[model samples]
Target: MNIHEYQAQKILKTFGIKVPYSILASNLEETVYAAKKVFKKTKNYICVIKAQIHAGGRGKGGGIKIAKSIDDVYKKSSNILGRRLVTNQTNKKGKLVNKVIISEYVLNSDKEYYVSIFYDRNIYKNIILYSKEGGLEIEDISKKIYFQKIDPYIGLQEFQIRKIAFHLKMKYSAFNNFIKKLYNAYIYSDASLFEINPFLITNDNEILAIDAKVRLDDNAFFRNLSYKEMSDEREYSIIELEAKKAGLNFLKLDGNVACMVNGAGLAMATMDMIKIYGANPANFLDLGGKADSKRIKKGLDLILKDKKVKLILINIFGGIVRCDIVAEGIIKFFEKKNKINLPIIIRLEGTNVNIAKKILNNSKLHYYYVTSLEEAANKIKVLLKNELRCFI
Candidate 1:
């Protein structure tokens, strides 16, 4: 779960970290008003209007603007709000910018740095990575990075914090306090990543986090109700949001084959099989154990929304869910929806398999029923290859 920079900054403030105060604005008038208010408080007319999308490279995308005057704020906000923001990471079509963060701009930082702490899954340990070199080129930045591995089981040790701060050449007293609070907040929030990019040191020797990029662990949402509420639907695709609301596990991928399976383990195995068969999976849609016609139809409908999906593979190994019952759900969906165009390959094993076969056979749809995994795989490869035409 990704949160906007403003949202992350607000959380940082609660942890006793120093951050430039900001107001969330969604329009031109609000932006103007926010600029005026911030200027009044800071006694400085200059402020920054930043786009509130989840992705980075905002500066290059014209998503980050420095407003020198109230007019500048209005003009920049007018151009940004409700416009599509294209960055290095975002698709060329871009993500729509629905809001902006009008914040008091910090001027003339003596130095800028990047610092992040997160669990390193490869080694199963928490790591803190800091670098003086901060920019778009990750490879270059990584080469100059100084890192420290923290024991997740024991948490961040006091000596380890001092060691990192010293390595970064931070001699100030306040920076130490800031690091402690930052570490505390990161652990308590169940954050997957807590990044402070361009964490600057002002001439006055004060530590300030100039940017916040935070991602909280979804599995830990049970302990973070407020964090869950901070979810911005704008960051997600319509189909993705819909799937989540429908209480189904789904993720869109880059492929032509749309897979709908019963269990997560089975869904993964199905995708792996598809790959082995020399075809990529378009999406992962796990229907779970108990699925009715409504749920099945909804899943199918969502999968069909992706135009790249040329085939639908329904793999079900029945135990609690009878094959015949699932087959009924499948038939019910196709009977109502249009575009009975794509070939559907179904491999149903276990209870009532014969009955399920009979139902599908009687449906008179362009369906392929394979009793063996190898047969299903071979059929998928042939159909996928045929549908994919040559340059001619």
Candidate 2:
């Protein structure tokens, strides 16, 4: 799960990594007080007011501002707090900023660098991605990045540290210590990604993480209970939160077709088939191995919540989950709702397929049923084409 920058900085500090003195605030008065606290603690007049959100590119989205005085801090914090911050990583609607971090502003840094550690799926090992050029334009200069892979079992090596330090022309002693501590922090935290952009070397020769972005592996949360508190439910939509509670995997998207499938791989294939047939998927919903009546009803309710959804596609390959159970759930849902405005397309195979088909055929609900993937694809193409024709 992704966390705010302030929380990431706090985690870094726990690992003996140096970061700018910062205070978290939720309002104008608190922001002003936090700025005073930072200035006094750091003995610096200038402080930075940064909006706390899960996405990056906050600086370009007017979420980061310089505060030279108490009044400046108040004004800047007022503007950021409660504002919807739109960044490249976020949607057009943007994310709401309920908190801001007021930090000591470092001026005239000797150098700015980008460093990140993440698991490389291709090689099945963790790798360090670093670059001499850092900042907001890192995306444009990605070709300049250097990748160094670390052995999962052996951990980071001394030679790898020296190679990166030499490439960046950094002092060996300081760089070595900083990298080791950072790597340890990443491993200890069970972080999927630990990034420090604009890693600063102050004029006083101190290494500091100016900006931090951390994402922890959700699967590893059992070992790190403290990290669970860092989760912000405000970052997720109500539907997504509900899905999580119901033991389902659901992600909302911007399209017209809502998909409900049994497995992750099949869900992906369903989405691809939708796109290939000249339609877009509205959401990714995985019903898991147990597609019971309650789960099916919950998934359908979640799908209907999105007003953008124009069609519902239920594709289930019943291995452990019975297809008849799924059919019963769909019929029961429509019975309670009395009416469904959107069209439903269902394709069920394996495990009581005949029984499931018989059940669905007897239900009097208006739905298109297909027997094969190829038939489903054709049905989707015709239905979506007809939908567009009606819209036009």
Candidate 3:
């Protein structure tokens, strides 16, 4: 649902927002060509080369650089293109940089500010937050700021834009246009979150959105086919992509205990219990309230694909989904694969629980069943301790 900065800039342009003149290029020669074109138009020898990746904090990880000359553009692009970019939001392993955005670099920016519009789930309203202190994380956002909660039914207004601009001490001529353009882009783009970090104010009284980050709502994917094509599979892991294709919600974490649960609520509780028991979850895979044999097999396969998983924990309190059906799927999956030594723990309750326990009891696979959440935690604690012994 997230897109690279160049794509975000395209969306901004569609709404008449001003951004730096730029070109997207995937290779060294293309990068130089893009810079040359920008220099010709803007007559600015200084160009910026940015690594195109989904995650932010790119500047902190050297994914962004300023090229003062054409030679600098080629050199920086070559070093960045094929490298794996690591940022604070991304894992230590980083992501592959397949392309770079070359743009005209602006100079003599008098001030920087942070501006973002996002839905505040706590209050279920869209919130617009901005601060003169730019290039800082949310935690570091300055107390001198503006937080406006707008009703989507009313849309944006001229006064709202003027207020923000006035507070930032922006020039009257440019602020009105900049604010209207950016707000309209957010409204029309079906964006879940839109942010412009370091929205630059140049000495020449021009406003420029220096960096943009946009995330689209997944539920609205059907409405925007163009946005779908902009999605990069390289943003996800192989297992993550496969899990998504299988209609499962999966996230890989830096832990060893693999969690399998029937609902998002239970999945969260299971992960919390794991932490309470002094263990970390390797992944979060929600099977939902419904599961068939194929889904069960796919879930198990996905769990096993994670090499960090030292123990598999299944927690099911069936409501719409029958526990017996889930148990049968689990047994048959292990039976077909003949996986007898894998460590699996289960806690089942509600909806044909008796039959489900019986099915699991008769299976040849090594599955430990518990009666309560506390017992499940204890079991995981014991198993993980023994697992640690093997490596130690």
Candidate 4:
């Protein structure tokens, strides 16, 4: 699960990672108080009052505002609160700003740095990432981070820390402390990935982790009460929450076609084929490798809920997930709903394919089943064309 910047800093502080002084505020009164507290520390301070939301690209979307005074802070916070913060990285509705983090910003820095740890499913290892170039325009920066193997059994080592520190060009004096602090933060947080972008070395040449982005393993949520407490009400869509409850990996996108696949790799391939077929997909819904009848129905329900979905495609290349199970699930879904007019095309292969086809046929529901991938795409295209013509 993702967390706010203030909470992330608290985690960092717990691990002895030095961060800028900050305070969390929810309303206008708290924002003014936070500003007063920071102002008391130093006048003419470069202050920043940022909207605390789970989404990114805040600066580009005016969610991160600079405040030169308490008045500026109040004004900025008022504008941000009660309004939706729409970033390039967020959905159209955007995340709500129930809280804001007020901080004393760093004055001057020529360069920035970033360190992150992400789980590489392909490699089956928790990978460490560090880059010298980090900050607001970080995406533009050349990705030259160090990657070290994380042995969950043993945890972080001096070797891995040194590798990241040396690569980041950290000062000789502060290298050891920085590495130790960052490593500790990574382990203690129970985080799948920890990111500190623009981990700054100040004008006086003091190291500080200016920005923190920690991605905790969702499975490990029960272990970390602190992370759980950081959950915000305005994180995701109702559909997203429902999808999670229904045990489906559903990501909403911009298009007319909604897709469902049985595996991660196959989901990606289905999306690619949809694009190749000149139709954009509205979502990426993975029903997983299991052929649980209930899950299949839930997946279908999630996709069909979208009014933009002109065509729904179910592409299942069954391995452990049997085609018959999927067909049975589909039949059950249709029976319960009584009727659905959405154009659906199914491409089922692998285990018990014939049995699946027979089950679908027995249901007497109108659906196109093609043996080849190309045939499935052609059928979807034709369906889309027919749908558009009917609408026109």
Candidate 5:
């Protein structure tokens, strides 16, 4: 799960990493107060106001502002708080900013660098990426970056640290200590991604992390129970949180076809087929391998909440989950709702498939039943064509 930048900085500080002194504020008055505290603590007049959101590119989205005085801080904080910040990493609608970070603004850094550690599934190893060039335009200079893959069994080697430090032209002793601490933090926190952009070096040779972006592995949340408090509910939509509560994986998308599948792989394939057939997927809904009637109803209810959905596609390759149970859920849903305006296309296979087909046939609901994915795609194509014609 992704946490706000302020939270990431706090985490890094726990690992003995130096970061800019910052305070969190939720309103204009609190922001001014925080700015005063930051300036006093850091002995600096200038402070930075950063909008607290999960996405990056906040600087470009006008979410980061440098304030020279109390009045400037108040003005900048007022503009960021309670605003919807749109960035390249976020959707067009953007994310709402309810809080801001007031930090001491550091100046005259000797050098700026980038450092990040993440697990590479393809190589089945943890990789550390570093670059001498670090800033908002780091993506454009990605070719100049260096990568070092670590052996999980043996951990980060001393030789690897030396290579990175030498490449960046840094003193070996200082770089070794800083990198070792960072690697330890990543392992202990169960972080999937730990990134520091603009890892700063002051004239006095003091190393500091100017910006931090961290994403923890959700599967490891049980071990790191305290991290739960860092979760910001505002980062997610209401329906998304509800799906999480129901133990279903759901992601809303901007399209006409809503998909419900039993597994993540199948869900991806279903969405791909929808796009190939000249349509877009409205959402990615994975019912999982052990879904029952109640869970299926919850998934369907979540799909129906999206007004953009013009069609529903239920594609099940049941192994651990019974297809008949899925059919029962669909029947129960329509029975209670009684009148759904949209069309549903179902493709069921494996684990009582014939029984599921019989159940669906007797349900008396207006749905298109197909035996194969190709047939389902054809049915969806014709229905979407009709929907477009009506719109015309």
Candidate 6:
């Protein structure tokens, strides 16, 4: 989950990482109060007011502003608060900026650095990325010559740390201390990504994390409250929560065809195929393995409630979920709902396949059953085309 810089900084503090003191404000008055409260000693102290949104590129979006004076701080916060900040990652309408985090800004030269640790599921390793050139062009700099390694079980070992430090041309004494501390922080926080863009070097030649951005793994939420609290209300819609509560994974998309699949990979491929067939998928719904009749019923109910859903598609490549079990689930859902009017296309290929066809054929619901994925897509396209014509 993406969090505000303030929240990420708080996590850093817990790991003994030095960070600036800050306060959060959601309004103009609060912004002024925060500016007054946080930066008391230094009149000419540099301050940054950043919009507390889930997405990134805040600087480019005008969500991040630097103020030279208290009045400037208040002015910048006023302009940012209650405004819609658009980033490359945000939707066209942009995300609403309701809160701003004001913090003391640090000063350093442009010769910054970048470091990050990520879990690559495919390689099944903890990968650490580092670059001497930090800030805006870090990614571009990475392409030139950077360092990355994949360790099976352990994270950045001492030798690996030394290698990165040496490769980045960091001073031996400082790099050793920085590498050890940073590596420990990466492990302790269970972060998927820990990045310090422009990991600054002060005039005293001391390394400081001027800007922090960390993304923790959601699967680790049971242990990480800091990441959980950073969640934004606008990030999840009502339909999404409903699906989650029902033990289904759902992502709402701009499409008319609603999909219900058994696995994540299957769901993604289904969405891709639907798009290829000139049909849009309204949702990515994964019922998961071992889903029973009740769960299936819940999934169907959730999809049917979406007014934009003109066609429903159930594609299950069952292994743990037998075809008969799925058939029973669909039957139970229709019975409970007392009616089924939407055009549904079903494609089941796995255990008890013939039995599933038998059960579906006996049902009174208006639906089509296809063995081939292409046939299902074609049928859904035709159904949606008819729906458009009827609407017109």
TM-score: which candidate is best? 5
Tens-digit lDDT string for candidate 6 (287-377): 9996678888888878877888888899998798898899888877776665445777889998898998898888765568887888888
What digit string (tens of lDDT, one per residue) describes model 5 on residues 1-392?
Answer: 89988889888889998988889999899998998898889888899999999999999999999999999998888889999999998899899999999988989565789999999988899999999888788888978999999988899998999999998989987788789989998999999999999897766676889999999988888998989888887888999989988989988888989999999989998888888889899999999987788888999999989988888999999798889988998888878885677888889999999999999888777788898877888888999888732110
Cα lDDT tens digits, model 3, 1-392, are: 89999999999988887788989998899999999998998987888899999899888899999897889888888889999999998899999999899988877455788889988877877888988778746446557778888788887777787787788777667787777777778877889899998788766666789899999976677887788888888888999899988889898899988988888888999999999989999999999867767788999899888777788888888788888998999888887774434578888899999999888888776678898888988988998788732210
Q: lDDT values of the candidates?
A: 0.85, 0.89, 0.85, 0.80, 0.89, 0.78
Candidate 1 deviant stretches above 4 angstroms: 108-110, 120-123, 135-140, 172-175, 262-280, 288-293, 316-325, 337-339, 347-380, 388-392
TM-score of 3: 0.90
**Candidate 1 lDDT tens digits, 1-392:** 88999889978988988898799998888899899999999999899999999898888889998999988888888889999999986877888999998998888655678889898987999888888655445335667798888888888777887787777778747467778898888999999999988787767777888889999987899997889888998888889899989988888888989999889888988898889989999999998987667778889989989999888898988888889988999988777766556888899998888998898888856688887767877888998878833110
Clashing pairs in 2: none
Q: Residue 384 CA error for candidate 6 (Å)?
A: 6.0
Candidate 2 per-residue lDDT over residues 155-252, each given as its tens digit: 99999999999888898887998999999999999999999998978666768899999999887989998899898989999999999889899999
After superposition, the stretches of candidate 2 with alpha carbons farther than 4 Å from their true spots are 371-378, 388-392
Worst 10 residues of 4 by lDDT: 383-392
**Residues forming the 10-long window of minimal summed lDDT in candidate 3:** 383-392
- Model 6, residue 102: distance off in Å is 0.3
Which candidate model has the greater lDDT, 3 or 5? 5
State TM-scores per candidate.
Answer: 0.84, 0.92, 0.90, 0.85, 0.93, 0.85
lDDT per residue for candidate 4 within 132-211, as digits (tens), equals 88877877765565567787667777776677777877765676777667767777677877888778776666679888
Query: In model 1, what are the clashing residue pairs, if there are any?
Result: none
Error of 6 at 365 (Å): 2.4
Comparing 1 and 4 on lDDT, the stronger one: 1
What is the total number of backbone clashes in candidate 2?
0
Q: Is candidate 4 or candidate 5 better by lDDT?
A: 5
- Candidate 1: count of backbone clashes, pairs at least 3 residues apart or interchain: 0
